[model samples]
Target: MKKVSRGQRKQTKRFSLHSNSFKQVVKELSKTLVSGLVVAVASNFLLQFFQNQFNFEVAWLFMTEWHIELFILGIGVLMMLYIWFTSLIGNRYIGAFLIILISIILGISTQQKMLLREEPMYPSDFSMITNLPFLVKMMSNTIFLIVLILLIAISVSIFWLIKRARKGKKEKKSQHQKEVRGLRIGLFVLSSLSLIYIYAFNSPGNLVKAAYNDHAYWIPYSQEMNYYNNGFVGGFLYNLNVTPMEKPEKYSTEKMNQLLLKYEEKAKKINETRSKSLKDTNVIYVMSESFSDPTKLIDVKVSKDPMPILRQRMEKNKSGEILSEGYGGGTANIEFEALTGLSMEPFASNLSTPYTQIPSLMNHFPSAVSYFKDAGYSATAIHPYNTSMYKRKQVYQELGFDTFLDEKTMTYADTLEESPYISDHSAYQEVLLKLEETDETDFVHLVTMQNHMPYTDFYPETTFTAEGTADDLEAANYFQGLSYSDKALNQFLEELTTQEEKSIVVFWGDHLPSFYGEEVVTVNGKVAMHQTPLLIFSSEKEKQESLGTISPIYFMNHVLELANSPVSPYYAFLMTLEANLPAFEKGMYIETGEQESKLEREELSSETQQLLEEYDLLQYDITIGNRHAETANFFSSK
Candidate 1:
């Protein structure tokens, strides 16, 4: 071989260096170009889907609006960049390839989510659509479209990769192209600048503050397209599940002293005349589902006894028409009302239970577990359904229960048929078992579900005694369910009486059963929902007159009185309402008596709106979390 010259050797070295550098540049360019395009396509598809699904104002509405979508896109972009960085670090093209694969999977998942009935991709609810027969057919079409798009994306990604590799090989001998390189860098910078601009100036409030401080600041974006998506943030997420302190400024202890004195005098009179030593009692609260007194029920003739058991309980036990605050159906609201003696009427609207929308109220309750627990009772709760159904597990535990038994650990004599719910008799069996197990020092809280319906359908034939009108039949079906529940109670009572020591069994229906169809409207009056059967049955049947006649809120005070437990100071009771609603009578009585005090103290007293908002915030805190409750703090200073 001929010996090479020094200049030739130097030229060879330069060529080798240039070749390697060019290859590296080409590889990075190819990876970014391919990955960026894939992400943009996926993002654009999401944008287009949202636009068709919702009327968004921005061009890339998915990225600009809908916080969830934005989060997804942000995560996608970050992943893509991460892939690009990793590729550079490892000196291999694997990062870009992995990103492309993940993008396709995510894109498919997003599209699939839109088609599912459970929480559609868009904020706009398609839940009503699920009721439609055509929904399944429509979803099939969506599936086909998503599948096609995914295939196309995959094919395009593969084609682009192959094209880049081919081009890189062909340009192996060429000098690095400076103009093309500059253009790529310029495009990257422009894209980044656009993202920042859109994020900053596109919405309301201080963007920086929302980004850093607002717990649900993303909500504005989440609902940028669908306005109804803007629900109470204090609900189910931010508010601490505590009862709110009533607006302290509204009523003063000095003003409330007048009422406290009256109560003191009344207690003195009752104590001086009435016997202070009360018998150990079993207070059975029968809570009928969706129960309301229908004027038509009084008029109509039916074949069966709808409320035979309840009627029997009412006649035999101390019963009254307890005015409940709800319509159609909201069980937890009534439960909250009954347990805390907090009237839900002041806060009632589309916003039903604080558990779902407000968690703050969980802690702000004017009455609490301590009240019952302090009264020489170990409170045990039983529900024959999923423990977490409606978040009951947490709510009940937080409210103060020594033992909470749901469907998970519940015993059943008969298997549940048709639905996941247990039979009424089986539920009662569990109640009886609990009653047997509890020490004499414990109290039982039972939430029954057998009466939940398809109204006429769920009523057991044996419980139904063919007797009144169609209204009677409805009542009868309710009674039949109640009768079955009553049988369970009778068994529980019989067992309880045999015990050497006594315990209180407080069993009440969560709400009246909700009837569907137009026929229901024709029968029940508009306000029929408020009329529910509230029966308090004690183990030892004393003259019924001894049972207190009062609202649910007052039940707490009375429970304290019955068990002879210590009552909170009147000031603490007043302050507690700051977080929860006191009964209508109590709130009104206080407001009425403090009229002069209210006029004297404007800033010190809570306005009607402020009280309602505070209550709402408290409810939100219990169900949601603390962040949501703080939103209502806007009114705190005012």
Candidate 2:
């Protein structure tokens, strides 16, 4: 080879330096891109899995405009930020570990909320969660691991390719410039495509940058026209196929009032049939959490009967599955039903709490309180938790209670239960003490919280067996809490029976215990709504009147009639497709009477939905202030 000229040698050295710098920059870029891609892929896959697994679509359908948008944006933003930060802080192994841990915690929390966030008796799909169990769990873990490894490898290889490309830079300068421009264009195109997607599919009414989301049948249409339509905007898309397929149900006010009147008559007839004079019977309503029908011998059984004390009283009391208007949670909604006796519409997102939203009804509480006051019963309400948690203090006082006692005043300083908390047993004791302390014969409402969630490690005084069969330590703890409450109740009743004053204890559960955290169990190819027991226990000497299988809405009315309180009128909707010519179950309504009208759960038969919907109205206002008064009395008399 000829000796290289000085100029050529200098040019080659310069080229080499430039090539090395380019390689370094490209390597760094490749690593950053790879990390981001891995995070995005993993997050999207996990999100899709969870959404499909839990029927989040139905939830989105039910959510209010604000909630829908808030939830989507909140979840998406939080998740993206978490992944983005994690990628910046750690290597693949650490990131993977964090992802798994966070996913599990998130899964549990979401599962709890999902389980409780629907109409009661929504059928579950046990097959999906239970089919292969250990295998599925193991496979999922493996898949994630494999994907993580593949991503790391891809990222490293891309970095190496950049190094090789840089070595050939001098000869390929013109070609390299062309490739760089093409890559930049491709990235821009991809970003534009993503923007189009977000705009098209995002829930309407939410500002894009302010960020929020929902889904109707129109999702496909919205997605297709995202470049222009931007979703439903004040009837601009009314002609679009994306509009809700289910038409807005319309009922004439006259027709609704007439229907309500009919139900009122039916309620009167129920009281007549029971023959338990509701005239002046003191009512005790006990709303237990996760108080399932399993406590009874007639239904399922736990290894050890958690609610033994209550079980003993079940035979004598007029009780059965109250067929709750809610499933895993929505305690307030159920409380609304027990109080108002109104039919709950499925499509109505504004049905959470009538007392909070419907001011007209809320404003009437003073009248209810005064009405009982005139009838010689002072109204008081008691809750075994922070009174302010649910705004119960203001609401209770507004509803006419002479006094409102919450966890703070009701719990004694020396109680075994501990600060910021009181057990159901302790709550019952407080109730009794209040009744004894009060000079007036009064109506009391009690809300208990000892049986509330994270049920496993919550009780300081009680230790659950962490061993076999009781895998449901959480549920077991909940029931144990309930049992303790029952024991307190039994003792209280014994004392009340000795008193000369006659009273009727109208106690029922506020809502079923939240089984949202429990793993879904499939028995005999069917999904079951864990049953809850509602009882109208009495200490008065009137003939023991027992009405069979009545809805919770009827429980108050039945008691009111027995005590001779004049009841407000109501109507039943009973339009479910399962029943022929719209049938009423007991004294309740069915917005959809058809068999398939189940609480949007597809696992159960359609007829089940009809039966479930019949009692759905108890989630609404039907019986005015009777429940509030009754609940107050139950707490005071405890």
Candidate 3:
């Protein structure tokens, strides 16, 4: 006020400019951070909404849960870190783009998982992306359009945000630039470590375990329940960790030695008493897709018995119920149990498919193919579908198959009239060709694809319709498909019977078809939806004996037993286990003299418990444990 110099006035102006610049920077940061957090929250709500099938009550329940709030908070922290990191690099737009893109992908996956009742997308699922061209055909127009819109919107938003950020003038270098850089680096490292710890170990007192007690801990058994109990994000993070298989109680080299010795002694006795041999017989295993008889379903009535031939053959052949580990899907797990003679019940629940997780981890998998190869038979697998589906091409190679015939390679792969999948008739024709091509006794593993799911209006005309019930399109479509499968089965059997070569045809349904509604098949107060029909037939017309209900783990063992074929000590151990315990699937075991009682493993007798312990130890050693498998003849033909 007394005398203003030009220099002082210039200094005062500079201070004012600096203060405004700081305020503008703060405002921009706040806007970007808040927008990112909003996007994260909205995406989570959308995921829950879709996953719960737009059921407001279930969606609300998920949102109201305390654990879900923590999950949201975790997602927010991740978004904030991404935004902050991108902002530091002068490209906050990329962070926004990534957020939107990931949200879209997760949303679609959640919807699919809900529909399929399958586990969330794993690293292995990405290998199936090659089948997207065919898979996309199965999607509805509405879903396809919605996804398209989402992608377009995301692209526009990303472009707009990037343009806006670029339009803003860059801030001048600050006096504490080094400090800001150091802080940003420190925050990034800290956030990364926190995320890794949370996802890797389920930290913060193991929230997943706290939410779900011991019973619901296995995610693959009931993934839907897991998601409902734990929030989507929480459940996903919990399942991300693939824990090492726990060693059987008191497992050791000496313990394994004792079990091997006991089994070796039993094997010696069985081999000495063996009467028949499967040396020259061609073994054909047909895992028909969704080939269960709907007439066995209780709630709904069909117009006629869809599987008349199978029912008639059941009386004259060695046919029975197979307690499949999967329902509707999970063919790979069912095949794994059949091929390896190893029950998935003992492995980690998250190890959903061994073909994807186990075979890749192990140097060699001692499978039925390897066993047959050792016994002087060429093993070949045939699937009338994409070889890349479930990574089967790689799996078959590792499993030691001499040849694998897939959709691309199969000569007789022709689609059915009302279905996109290859017909069982055509698949059986390929089986005949393989039999003709190979002079040696071949182990032919055929997985049919005629009756795969999506029981929609694919059939222009329906031959069979649901009777004694309201009109249901899904049921009618399913029945028609089942009818086709039955006819194919009859034709295949006729061809097999006429063949001059002595062959054993093991036919079984992989699992029941997933119906649209809640009307599931049940038997004796227990859900029989997981059970499928199995038939073991011989072209030579051997004595037909009903095997009753059996677990898939004992499938190949029974095949060997019925053939009176020589088996290794490992198989002898399986025979003993199967003889003692009634056939059962995971989460339920049939007790020693109780055909109907389904009890937990803990409820078994002391002797049965010891046998189970030995089984678990041997399986662990052969699969997840050290290379002690070769130390004994557990997987050898000794």
State TM-scores per candidate. Answer: 0.51, 0.54, 0.87
lDDT of 3 by residue, 1-638 (tens): 69999999999988877676666656555766677677667666666666666566776666676455555554564465565556556455676667667656766766665655444545445556788886677556788798889889889988986788668667788654554455456555765765555565433466434544442333545556666565565555555656535777777888778788887888888878666666678889999887786666667678878888888888887888788877657788888888877787777665556777666643355567877888788789999988887888888888888899988899997877768888889999998998899878889999988877666775769877775323367778878888888898889889888888878888899887655334343332343667789898887775567777787777768677777777778888888898877476656677556756454677777777777888778878876676466566567654
User: In what order do the candidates fall by lDDT, top score first?
Assistant: 3, 1, 2
Which scores higher on TM-score, 2 or 3? 3
Off by over 4 Å in 1: 1-288, 291-301, 346-351, 358-368, 413-420, 455-483, 503-507, 516-523, 545-551, 557-638
State the C-alpha lDDT per candidate.
0.46, 0.46, 0.72
List model 2 lDDT by residue over 192-233, tens digit each: 554444444324553443342233222221222221122212
Of candidate 1, the 10-residue stretch with the lowest lDDT total is 231-240
Clashing pairs in 3: none
| Candidate 3 worst ten-residue window by lDDT | 516-525
**Reference-based lDDT, residue 471, model 1:** 38
